[model samples]
Target: MSEDVLVVHGGTPLRGEIQVRGAKNLVSKAMVAAVLGETASTLYDVPAIRDVEIVTGLLEAHGVKVSTGPEGELVMDPANVTRAAVDEINVHAGSSRIPILFCGPLLHRLGHAFIPDLGGCKIGDRPIDFHIQALREFGAVVDKRPDGLHLSAPNGLRGIKYELEYPSVGSTEQVLLTAVLADGVTELRNAAVEPEIVDLICVLQKMGAIIKVHTDRVIEIQGVAKLSGYSHRPIPDRIEAASWGAAALATHGEIFVRGAKQADMMTFLNVYRSVGGAFSVDDSPIGGGIRFWHPGGELQPVALETDVHPGLMTDWQQPLVVALTQARGLSIVHETVYERRFGYTTELRQMGANIQLYSECLGGTPCRWGRRNFLHSAVIAGPSKLHAADLQIPDLRAGFSHLIAALAAEGTSRVYGVDRYISRGYEDFDGKLAALGARTERP
Candidate 1:
C-alpha cells in the first residue's frame, strides 16, 4: 500500500474496536499551553496526528524541548523557550492555524512574537481579527505586514474586561492563554464553554493559575506572576468516536469505540438515537467505551442544528450526513457554525446521494447565516443508492465523511488526499479501518 490514495471496496460494514486518544482540538492547545509553564509539562493520551507534529515543530523552533515518553505521552520543556525567526516559524507552520495561538505565550515569555501567514481548513472565513483584537485589549501591540503580523507587549500584558461578538473557541483560548499570566484580572463575556475549554482550564489550574467559570458563559481569570508545569490526561476525541459511530450506522455495522466517554457525547448520542441508532455504554473494569450499531430497520430522518457546545456539533454533522443518506425520509441539517461546510455534500451527491444545498435556514432556527446567502443548510432525501467514484478530500472532517460514504457505497472507490487532510486529526486511520474489517488499500 502506498501513502497517498486509498482504494476502498465498499458494501462492507466496519465491525471491530478502535482506540481513540486525546482530542486533536485539546491536544494541540495543551501543547501550546505548555509554553506558558516555567518548567516541563507532561501530557498523556496524546494522539499521533499532523497537528501535534506541527505544534511540536513550532514549539521546538522556539527552543522548547519536546520528547516522547511512554506510548501516547508527550513531555514538553519550556524552560529554554525563546523567540523564533518569522521565516523559521513559517516554514514549520505549513497549512496550520496553530501559529496564531502562539502569540500570547510568546509575548509573555519574550515580550515579542511574530506570526506567519495562517492557513487551515477551507470551511469558512476564519479570520485572525478576533485574535488580534483580543491581544490588543490585553495591551499588546500588533503590527500587520505582508510577511506576517508582529506582536509585542511594550508595557507588559494587562488584563481587561472583554466580550466577544460570538462565542468563538479560538478567541476564547487566546484570552485564556494571555490572561493567565497578565497583570490584573480578566473577565470574558459570552465565552465558549466547550468541554475542551474546561479541560484547558483544568490544565491551567494545575499550573497554579486561578480561573473561574460562571453561569451564562462567563469566565474570569486572575493574573498570576509565575506558573509551574502540569501533568494531565487530556479528554478523548469525541468527534472521532462519533464519526466512527456514524460510519457503523451508515454501513449497517457495529463498532466498539474504546475510551469514548458517554458524558462528553450526550448531544451526539441523543441525535444518534433519534436517527434510529442504538448505543450501549460500558463502565466495567475491563474496558470503558460506547458500542454503536444500526438496528436493521429503516433509519429515521432527523432535524439537526449545529451550534456551540451542548448543541449539535458542526464536525459531527458531516459523518452523520452519510448515515442520513441511508435513512428512509428527508433529513434536514442546518449548519449554523460554518457557512461553507456544505460544499462537501456536492461530492456525496456525485456518489448518488440526494442532497440539496440551500442559502436559507431550513431547520427553523434563526441562525447568523440565515440571510447571508451562503449554502449553510442542507435537505437530504435519503435511501439514495450510493455508488463508488473517484473522491477528492476537501478538509479534515469532510474527508472523513467522504471515506464513510465510500465504505458504504456499492463498488470500489478511489479516495485521494487522505494523507494530506485526514491525517491532521485522525491517527492511524487506514490501520484502524483495516482492523475494523474494511477492505481498503493504497493505490
Candidate 2:
C-alpha cells in the first residue's frame, strides 16, 4: 500500500550498480515444483517480490511449509501436502496466474485441486486452453463452476504426446509439471525453450524427473512414480537485467547490473549494441555482471520483432521501446508474441513520445497477428524530447518502462498504481532507484 503512488522529478541520468536475484519467471515455478517433491526442497536467490509472497501463501494454503533457510534461500517442505480449502486457495491466488500451474503438482499429490479464478498482467489473450487440454489429455476431469475451476484425476494421470499450437511459456510449464509425475512417457513438441523453462526442467531433473531436450523444439519427459526434494539456484532475472540496461540507455547513464548473465541474453545484447548502447560483460567469479551505458552519441534505431526463444523476447520489448524513443531515426517494433502488448504505448505517447501503432506486421517477417487486425506493430520516430505527464502503471513490465520514461522526460511525473501492478514482479524498485540516484518520493 505504501507503493501506491510515486512522484518522480525527471530529466536526470541514472547511474550506479544494482543486483538482480533469481528470475521472476523461474523462481515461482521452482517453488511450485517443490510441491511435486516428497521431501523438502531448497531454492537459493529467491527474489523478495510480491509474486514469491503469493506463491508462498498459496503453498501454505495447500499445507506446504515454506520458510527461509539462509540468506536469499526459500525452503519448501511438501511433507504434508494436502487439498486446501476453496476460500483459502482463492485468498492466496486471487490475483495471480500461478494457481493454474498448481494443477499438475496438486493432481499428483492429492487426487484433486480447486483453482480460483486467476488474474495476472492484462497483456493480451493469455489463454489457458492449452493448459486445460493438456490436463484433460493427462486424464484430469475439469469442471468449470461459478466459484472457480475444479479438477480431479479419477483414473490417475497418464502421459500423452502433446504438441503446442504455440510455444507458450505457461502452457509448457503446465505440461512439464504434469507429465513429470504421470504414469508413462510424455513427448511435448514445440515447447518453449526459454532460459526460465530450461531452469525449471533442471529443477525437476534434480528431483528425479527424467527430461530430455532436443535441438529442435521438442522435450521428452519420462514420468516417474515418485520424486524427492531438490536444491537449486535459479537463473538470474534476465528480464530485470534487460530492463536496467534499457533504463541506462534511455537516461543516458551507465549501470552495472550484478548477476546478469550474457549467455541468457545474447539476442537482447545484440539488439542493445545495435541501438548504440555500449556494454561490457564481466564473467569474473568475484565481480561478475554486465555493465550497460549510453556511450555519448545519438541512439541508433533498428527494426525488431518479438518471437519465441532465441528471438527478441516480448517482455524485453516495452523497456527497450522507451530507449528507442531517443533513437536518431525511425525504430520499427513488431510485437508478435502478444496481441495487446503495445497497450502501454498510449501512455508513452502521452509523455511526448512519437510512437504510432499499426495493425500490419511492419518487421521483416509476417506473424500471426499480421492479419488479425491487432495493433501489434509500432513505429517510433525519435530524438523526440520527452516531457513528463501523469501516467498510470498498466502492467508489470510497462510499469517499469513508464518509470524509465519518467526519468528521461523533462518535467515531473506522477506514476500511480505502483503498489498494485509493478510490485508483482520488481523487487524493491524504489530502493534500487534511490541507489541509482533518481529522485522519487511517495505521494
Candidate 3:
C-alpha cells in the first residue's frame, strides 16, 4: 500500500463536518508522559497513525502494557516498564522525532536507554543536538552509537537552567519530560511554546508535576519524586483545521471546521481574511471552532510570511498558496521556516500556475530556508486554470496541499503517497469528500 498512488478526481466541492481526532502532536507526547506516571493513563480519541503505532510499540517494548479498545481508546500502564529491547528500537527507527523523548523517562526509570535515529517531516536537517544538549544539562550522559543512541544517568538526574538555540519542538518536549522527575527546578528559556507544547505541559501538570509558565518565554519545572497518572483531553489540531479551511478557499467551497480553535489560528484567520475570504468563528471558553468560506468578491493577493506559533505557521503556507491560483493578482509569500518547502511550487507550475523563486529575501528577515535553492521567496501569479495530472506528496502538510490542488483542478489527479501518511491527521477523508459532493474513489 505504500507504493500505491491515491487517484483523485478534480473539480469536486468538499462539504461536510470532518471531526478531527486527537492531535498527532498531542497523542505522541501524551504517550511519552504516560511513562512518567505511576498509574495507568487512558487516552481517548487518539489518532491511528504510524507514529502512534511506533510510540505504542516502543512503550510495549519497555514492558508497559498498552491496549486499545474498539473505539480507539488507548490504555497505557507503565508500572512494569524496565528496559526497552533492541527489537523495540528497530520499530521506531526513522519514524519520528518522538522516540528521542523516551530518553528522559527511560533514563529516570531504568537508568539506561537507547533511542533509535529520529524521523519526521523531512523539511530540513532537524538534528537532535538541542535535545541532547538540554538532556545533558539535566545530568544525563549520552553516547552516540552506530546503531542507536545509548544514554545513562547512573548518578540520577539533577535539573539545571537551560536555554535553547532554536525552539525545536522535539527538543523542547525532551526538556519538559526529563525535567519532571529531576532533583530540582529546571528553567527552560526560548522554548517553542506551540499550542501542542502547552497541551503537553497541561498533561504533565495534571499528573502532579509542578510547572509554571511565565510570559518571558520561560518555563520553570520543579522536580518531583513521582507523578500520578492523568486523563486529559488534548487540544484540537490547529494545523489540520487550517488545512481544511485552506481547502475551502482553494476549491471555492464553504466549510465549517468543527472543533477548531480561533485563538491558536488568529494568524491564519487574519491572512485568510486578507485574501478576500470570509470566516465567522465561534469562540468557546476553552477551545473555539471556525466556519470558513471564500467570499463572493474580488480575491485579493497579499504578502505572506511563515513564523512560529502566533506567526503564520510554515505548514499552512503550501495549501493556502494554492488558493492564490484563483486570486486576480500576484501574491508574494516568504517562507521563513523550511527551505525545501518551496519545492512544491515546481509541482504546482506543472499544473499551470505562474510562480517564480527568488534568491534574495525580497525584503524581510531571510529565514532558515533562505540562501539555499532560491529560498526566502516565491511569487505566485494566480487565477490560472488548474489542470490535474499525477501529483506526489513529499511531506505531510505538502501532501494535504497537493490534495487540495488536485481537488480544485479541472480533471483527475493521481496523488502518490496519500496512503503514505495522510490518514495520520485527516479522519474519514474519503467519506468527508463524499459528503462534500466530490467524486473520488480509492483505486
TM-score of each: 0.99, 0.99, 0.95
Q: After superposition, how far is residue 48 of candidate 1 from its true place, in Å?
A: 0.6
Candidate 2 minimal-lDDT segment of 10 residues: 87-96
How close to the true structure is residue 317 of candidate 3, measured as C-alpha lDDT? 92
Deviation in angstroms for 210 in model 1?
Answer: 0.4
Clashing pairs in 1: none
- Ten consecutive residues with minimal summed lDDT in candidate 3? 367-376
Q: In model 2, where do residues sit more than 4 Å from their true spots?
A: 1-3
The Cα local distance difference test for each model comes to 0.93, 0.93, 0.82
lDDT of 3 at 145: 79
RMSD in angstroms, candidate 2? 1.0
